[model samples]
Target: MRAGLATLVLLALAGYVFLHYQTGGARAPECVVTGTGTGEPYRLQPQQAANAATIQAVASSRGLPERAVTIALATAMQESSLRNIDYGDRDSLGLFQQRPSMGWGSEEEIMDPVYAAGQFYDHLVQIPGYTTMPLTEAAQMVQRSAFPDEYAKHEPQAAMLTAALTGRAAASLYCTSAMDPAPGDPGEIRGRLAHEFGDAVRTDHSGRDITVEVPEPELSPQGWEVAHWAVAHAAEFGVERIVHRDRVWEARRSVKGWQAAREQDTADGLLITVAP
Candidate 1:
């Protein structure tokens, strides 16, 4: 009887393993976060990854340091899990949960991720020595949340996200997305780029391919910022591939993340190819 029971247990375990592999259980889409030099990575969903990227972009465009990005991200993670939502604690809405009643912005403006981020930074810089202040204290100065200490726990994850989004974690940001063949709209891409990076991003389209140029030389961080942003929004924008520096990310095999690329005339600026 004992021998028979053991055999049944073994069979059940085997069946479960087989079923797990057959269903793509462990292979589901996810976002990966790694440290700049060396540290364990953190994993989260694609939407969170997009929100992180947007927060970083808005901060960088304002010429804020990576420290500012870390604080903003930590605050958002604690407030809304990095999501731009329409609901929050009474009168609060969007990431960072800024209350419209407190003069952060109109409900419609706060809902815009870029504008919300800008508002957060605008207040953050006003705090004397916010750059050197403790993460929790700095965040509290702006939020005045009932539970101020909650922001501390999120700082490590926020730092990791800042590293990846700001290009310090080189080749570290990627999102798993469904395969879609439709081409992205060049007009929309140009507009979004302008909104984030300002009018400095020179955009021109040739057929389905959209080219964005940051004419200044040796702007690796700035270039990578744009490249990673394209990757984060690839599925939404139908980006086929992104080439910057010596690495390339292609939609067909984006699961592998950034990879070494073939030599090309990338001297003028980073190149992004959109799908048709």
Candidate 2:
């Protein structure tokens, strides 16, 4: 077998071990992010990946740089492990653990990942030179956490996530299809895309397949942004396959991560096929 195929075989086996390998009964949906040359992969529960996607989408909608994304991710990873949890120390809640008592937002608003991420950016941008400061310092200025340096520990992983989610690094993320008994709903995916990425995201649906046209106006982070987003939510949304540029990932074969797509799939935009 060729080198790439060999890599795929190993990765598929890895996926089997982590994704489908038995542990008591069954496994929850999961996503793995690599491609930072770290030689180590970062794993996320479906919910964590979904929350990170929201955070990245929020930053992109505001035209923030990758640095901002990295900072926000690290903060979220440190705060609540990227889950929109309902509780935290004291009154802290949501991904950033923003306390409603401290004026971040109402308890309901803060628990919404999109709202919470937006609130975090609203404060992040106000910092005079947040982009230039050290990651921990920038995060500290926004979140008055007791241990500021803790954010630094997650910076590397956060940076890796940023690269893949931002479209800077292609084909770096994939997930085992979530085993929802219901067939995937194209409309649901469309609405969620709009909610997190805004109505500006161009998309189309033909049955269970959703095609997202690359944001022609801005290619910098458009295509892969949606590509990774689709994959990260695959397990949660029942997405069976995703194709972008020259790569493809299938729910049934997710362990291979992103394999080289066939010649015919070499289109500009990407395609997402949901469970039937």
Task: Report the Cα lDDT for residue 153, model 2.
Answer: 96
Q: Worst lDDT window (10 residues) for model 2? A: 19-28
Stretches off by above 4 angstroms in model 2 are: 1-28, 178-181, 215-220
Cα shift from native, residue 99, model 1 (Å): 1.2
In the range 107-168, model 1's lDDT, one tens digit per residue, is: 99999999999999999999999889999999999999999899999998898888778877
Candidate 1 structure lDDT = 0.81
**Ten residues in a row with the worst lDDT in model 1?**
21-30
* RMSD over all Cα atoms, model 2: 7.9
